[model samples]
Target: MYFYNLLSKLKYIFTLVITTPYYGWIIFLQIISGFFSIAGIPMLIPVLEYIRTDISGAEKQGHMGFFNYVFSFIGVRPSFYSVLIVSSVLILLGQILVFVSTTIAQFAQIKLSGEYRKKLFNSYLAVDWLWLTRDKSGEMNHAIIREVELASVAHLNSQRIVIYLTQLMVFLALSIKLSFKVTMLAFVIYGFLIIINAKNTSYVQSLSENFNETFKRLSTLTANILQNKKFFKSSIAYKGFVSKVFHCIDQTMHTAKILNIREQLQISWTFLVTFTFLICLIMSHRILRVGFSELLVVLLVFQRLSPQFSSLFENYLALNKNIPIHQSITHRLNDIKKNKELCGDEIYQFNKSITFKEVGFRYPEGKRVINNINLEIKPCQTVAFVGTSGAGKSTILDLILCLLKPARGTIFYGEISHDRLDIFAFRKEVAYVSQ
Candidate 1:
C-alpha cells in the first residue's frame, strides 16, 4: 500500500499517454477497451437481477441518472424491453471496442518491441570491440533480448493503471449514489485485504526472483550444451561439463519445486483473502436495514468492483515479481552504456605505430599480467613478440591495442595518449588477428 520507491519507479511506465504519441494511442485504446467491457457487465447486472425477480416490466424499476439518460436517448424507457435493448447494444459495442483495441494495442506492442530491439542492436554496433569480448557472446545476446523484452512490456503498467482507475471511479460513483455506507464498509474490508497482502509481498518477491534466476540458469545451461553438440560428441571434457550442468540444473530445479509450492500457497492466500472480504460485504449488507433490492444492487456492484480491486493487487504482485529481473537487466545495460561512453570516439586508425610506455596490468585475481613493460611497434614494419606460453606477449599486444589500460603507465597512438585520444576513433584504424 505504501511502496513509495516502487511507485516512483513505476511512474514513467504509467505515464504512457504523455511519454509518446504512438504509445498514447495504444494506451487510450486499451483503456477504452477495458472500461467499456467492465462497465457493460455491471450495467447489465441490474437488468438480469430484475428479470430474475419475475419483474415482467422495467417501468416499475426506478433508475435515473447516467444509465437512464443513455436508455432514454435511444427512445427506450426503463422497461424490461428497453433494458434488454440497451444492455445488448452496450455489450455489442463493448465487444467491438475490445476487438479493435486489442488488435491495435497488440500491433503497437510488437512495433515498440521491434524498436527496442533495434536500439539495443544499434548500441552493440556503436560500442567498441573490447567491451564486446569481455562477456561471452551468448550472454550478451541473452541480455539484449531479455532487456528489450522488458522495455517492450513497459506499457502494461499504463494499461492496468488506466483501466483500474477508471473502473474504480465509475464503480465508486455508482455505489456511493446507491449507498455510501455500503461503499465505505467495502473500502474498509478492501483496506484490510491490502494490508495483509502488503505483509506477504516481500517474501513473494524474493521467491519470485529466486525462481526466475534458477529457471534462467537452467535454460542457459541447456542452450549452451545444445549449441555445442559437435564438441560434446568429440571432447572428453564435455562429459564433465555436461555432468556439472545437469547437477546445477538438478539443484536449481529442486529449489524451483519448493518455490512453486510457496507460490501456489501465496496464490491460495490471495484468493482466501478476497473470498473473506466478499463474505464480509455480503454479511454486512444482509444485516443492514437497506431494502433487498438495494442490497442486491450494492452487492452486484461490489462483485464487479472487487475484481477490479483484485486486479490492482494482481498487477502489484506481477510488478513486484518482475522488478528484480528488470533491475538486474537495467544494471547490466547501464554498465554496457558506461563502457561504451568510456571508450571515446577512437576507431581503429593505427598507421602501423603503437607504443606502451612502462605498461603494467593486474588481472582480477590480483596477479600481475604485465609489469613495467615497455614496447614499441614501428610504422609499417613487421614486428613480432615470441615467448613461451603464458609469457606477457599477448598482454603487451592487448595494452598496445588499448583493449586493456595500463595500471602504471600509458599507451600512445601516433604520439596521442590513448586514454586522452578518442578510443572509438582510434579503434577504427586498428585490425586485430589473434590466435
Candidate 2:
C-alpha cells in the first residue's frame, strides 16, 4: 500500500514537472551544476599530497595515479600549484552554475504559480453557477493563492532534491574510491537514519494535511465574517461568530507549531547521529592504520557526504509534506472541470416575444421555487415579479436570463428553445439590474 501511494505521488510530481514551462532547461542546468559542484572532491587528494610532501621536505612527485593521467591528458603537469589552481577553478565554476540555476529556478517558480492561479480562476469562472455557489469563496481563494504558492515551493524542492541526490551519489562514489569499507559503513549509517526518521516523515505529512485544512477553514471563516460584518455586528450572535474565527486561527497556529517542532527534531536527530559517526570515524583512525593523507582525504569526503545526506533526506520530507497540497489543488481543479457549464452552439435571437411554456424550477435540495408556469412578454416590454422573501422572483429572473436551467418545460425566444440557444449570445442581449 505504501509503495503504491509513493508511486502515485511520484507520478503526480512528474506530471507537474513536465507540464511546467522551462522544466527541461531547468533540469539540464541542475544536472550540469551538480557535476561541476562535485568535480573538485577528487582534486583534494592530489593537492593534500603535494602539501604533505612540501611540509616534509620530500620530493614532490605526481603520486596521484588517476589524477596524474588526467593532468597529462589535459596537457598540464601534475604540480602543487597546477592542481590547486584547477581545483579552485572547478569550485568557482560550480558556484557560477549554482547561481545561474537558482536564478532560473526562481523565475520558473513565479511563472508557474501565476499560471496555476490564472488557470484556477478561469476554471472557477467557467464552472456551473450552482456548483460555484455551493463552493466557499474563501476556500477557493485559498486554493488559488496559498495552495498554488506551495506547489511552486514543491517544484523548487524537487529540483533541489535532484541536485542533492546527484551530489550525494558523486560523493559516495568518491568516498568508495578512497575507502570502500568506510564508504559502505557510511551508507549503512545513512540507511539507518532514514529508517529512524520514517515515522517522523509520516507524522510531518499528517501535520501538513492538518495545516492545510485549518488554514483553509480560517480563510473561509475570515471571508464569511468580513462579508457579513454588518449582520454580525448588529446581531446578538456576533460573539459566537468571532469565537469561531478565533478557534480556526488557533487550530491553524497549533498545527503550524507541531509541524515546526517536528522539523526541528528531524534536524537535531540528523545532526546528532552524523556527529556521532564523525567522532567514531576519527577515534578509529589509529586502529585502521590508514596513511595520514589518505585518511584525511577520506574524512574530507565524509564531511561533505554527511551534509548531502542530511539535505537529501530533508528535501524528501519537504516533498512528502507538499503532496497533500498538490492533491487538494488537483482534486479541486478536476471538480471544476467536471462541473463546467454546458452550452449549445446556436446563436440566440429575439424577434417577437419571450415565452415560458409550463416552466418550472427548484433548488437542488429545496422545495420547488416555481412550477407549471406559463408567461409571455413581447420585445421591449417590461415585467415585474412581486413576491415576499424566499419567493421565486430572482429564480424566475435567472431562468429568463438563462443563468439557471428550468427543471421542467421550456423557455423560448421567438420559438427557439432556451437550451438550443447559445448562452453567451443570449446573455449579451440581457441588461439586468439586481438587488
How many clashes does each candidate structure show, in the order listed? 22, 0
Clashes of 2: 0
Candidate 2 lDDT tens digits, 1-435: 866766775686677667666767777776676676566666766668766666431244444556667777999876778878887887678668767776777788788889889889777877788897899999988998799998877887777666677778877887777777778788898889977776688778888998899889988988898899899889999898889989988888888888888888898899899999888988887776656787888887778778878887797789778867877888898999999888877775666788999999888997898998999978876678899997888888888877789999999878678888788777887777657
Scored by CA lDDT, what does every candidate get?
Answer: 0.64, 0.80
So what's the TM-score on candidate 1? 0.73
Error of 2 at 199 (Å): 2.0
- C-alpha-based local distance difference test score of model 2: 0.80
Model 2 worst lDDT run, 10 consecutive residues: 55-64
Candidate 2 lDDT score at position 126: 77
lDDT of 1 by residue, 86-142 (tens): 666665775576456546655665676676566667776455445666655555565
